[model samples]
Each structure stands twice: as C-alpha cells, then as structure tokens.
Target: MASRLRTGSADMAPPISSGRGPVLWGCALAVLSIALGFGCASTSPARFPSGRALQLNVPYFPQQVGLCGPASLTSVLNYWREETSVEEVARAVYLPQLNGALGIDLTHFAQKKGMQAESYTGSLLDIKDHLARGIPLIAFLNLGGRVFPVGHFVVITGLDEAREEVIVHSGSEANKPIPYQTFIAAWEKTRYWTLQVLPPRPASL
Candidate 1:
C-alpha cells in the first residue's frame, strides 16, 4: 500500500497568475531528481509521438502491491522503455529506487536523440519556457511534509494553454494521469525539481 500524507491549508503557496509563473511543487520535484552526468548527445533516431497523443491513450493498470503506492515503478519503467515514447516518459512516477533509473533513462534518451537536457535549479518560469518549446523536464520534489509525508515521484507531461494547468503522469498512485490543477497543487508543497529540454526529432536523423 502507498503511504498517504496530509497537509494543512496554510501550506499552499499563493497562486501564480500565469501558467509560466512560479510553480512551487513542479519546480521542487524537478530539482530533487537531478538528472546529471548523463551526456546530452543527439543521435537523430526514429520519430516519436507528442505529449497530446500519449495523454489521450494512457493505459490503465491496477495499482501494484507492497510498494509505496498503487502504481509500480517497475511497470512504469517497462512501459517507457518498451511501449511509450519520449513524451510519455514525462508523465510517470516511480518508487524511490527507480527514480534514479528514470532520471538516467530520460537523460540518456534526450542525449541520444540530440535533445537538449538542461538543469533548471532556481527558476521554474525558465523551466516552463523549456516545456513550451516541447522540451521534456525532470523535477525533484520533497514529498515528506506536504502531499504525503512518505515522499513520492512524478513526471510533468502536458500543459493546457487555456486552463493554464500542467499535466503530469504520476506513478505509485493509480492508472490515471494526473490533471494539471491537481499536479500543481501537490507540486507546490515540494518546490524542488529539475527541467530537461527535449527538442523535436530530426526528420532524416
């Protein structure tokens, strides 16, 4: 079973007016993972689907047993490596041990495809800018006190321009992808995450 943690109303950060404005939770999650050392090289591989496609076709799996939460990190990783594309990788959450693996996998994939993997430590606004450019961002969040004291992992996947919400795929929770609002709320409490920029795949490679 996954550990559940509670937070008081006082914990919430003042909402930012713009989607690109400051994001407490999202940025926090990005920094903690810290996808470093992995070379950011580009190989020009086969084209992969975009964020919109993955969000619509996200498969539902029953939460696993004996881990932190419902979804199993292993299952998510397998899906990323075998079934899903680079876009889908942004929307997954793995258990503690697998978080590092996820980070490494993403960093490696970005480098392999010639995508730019950047480190955004201070400003989430800059991070969001990268996302707008179709770059995949990784974040590190401290889930100890706010969302769930037990701590957790999550990936930021999609963004809704009209609603100004950030879409995310979180594992250890359930089969469903996390909505923008919910992701923002949970992320604010943990304000430490990293952002990686994934560029468009070259046509000829």
Candidate 2:
C-alpha cells in the first residue's frame, strides 16, 4: 500500500494559500522562533549556560503560575479572537480532570503568555525543523517503546546544535527538564507532537 501523507490538523485550516509548500513550514518555524525570543534575553552570556537550557524561575503549573496567568489569558484572547490565525490559551496548571489530557493546562498557560493557542499535526521531521530555530516545541511521547508515533505532551526547550539533539520539558513537578536523548526515545514511537509559537505581547511602557 502507498504511504499516506500526514497533515497537521492544528495549523491546516481553510482558505488555503497557493504559496503552500515545504518552504511555508520553514517560514512558520522561523516566525515561531522570533515570537518566542530564544536568544533575545538581556542576561549576560557568562550567566547563561553553555547549553540552551532556559532557566525557568517560574514554577510548574498549578503549583505556580509559571509564565503567565488568568489575566494574561484574557489579554491573549482579546487580541487573537478577531484574527483567523491560531490562538494561545494560557492558564494556571490544574490537576487533570476527567479529560485526562494534561496538555489542557499548558494550553491555558500559553494563552496567559499572550500566545496564539493552536496545535499542529505533523511528524518529528516537521518538529525538528521548527526546533532547529529558536522556537520551542511541545511533543507527545510513546512511553512504551519506539513506535511510529508517541502519546505524551512534552516541550523542546533547548537544542544541542553540535549533536543535533533537543531538550524537552515534560511538565514534571519533581523531575528536572528532560534531555534530548530521553525525549527522542519516547517521541520516536508515535512521531506525534504539538508545536506552537508564542508572539510577544504589546509593550506596557
């Protein structure tokens, strides 16, 4: 049987443009990096770790607001509601409800950070392209073994450019952020992961 092309349901909406191609995904990844501000920090280089691991003082969800809050979510929604583009839904982390998707709280957290909340449906290749830039990525893991696609939501925070590796954030309150090898082993199974780019909010000053 012929292999079927996997399309990302999250980013692929109607009003399709003619410019659609692999390049479009690249452009999107670039935009995601710009919006996320990977290397835009003012902190001195010496203070920063050699690895791109971001030191998140912000606590984990539910335990701490982490990046933003309810007010932030309102702000993100207010700006994105009118637009046809994706939206970011940010909120404080809460214990999983009956839904069982822990990612829901992260979505809420993204909204609070004033990012457009949307998910992408693509394979690890697409994700690797995005992470190649500064854009952070959220990928699902298999947890079982190396499969075609995975089933866990984790974020790619840093990249080992030399080694062609990535760092993932697995919403673990106790464990430290995950390393590239550990994340890839889990993600290789399903190749199922979500990607999002957080645009900067308007300056308050």
TM-scores for every candidate against the unseen true structure: 0.39, 0.40
Highest TM-score against the true fold, candidate = 2
Per-residue error for 1 in candidate 1, Å, reads: 30
Error of 2 at 90 (Å): 10
Determine the backbone clash count of candidate 2: 28
RMSD (Cα, Å) of model 2: 13.0
**Which candidate tops lDDT?**
1
Give candidate 2 regions above 4 Å deviation: 1-100, 145-152, 161-164, 171-182, 188-191, 200-205
Q: Which 10-residue span in candidate 1 carries the lowest summed lDDT?
A: 1-10
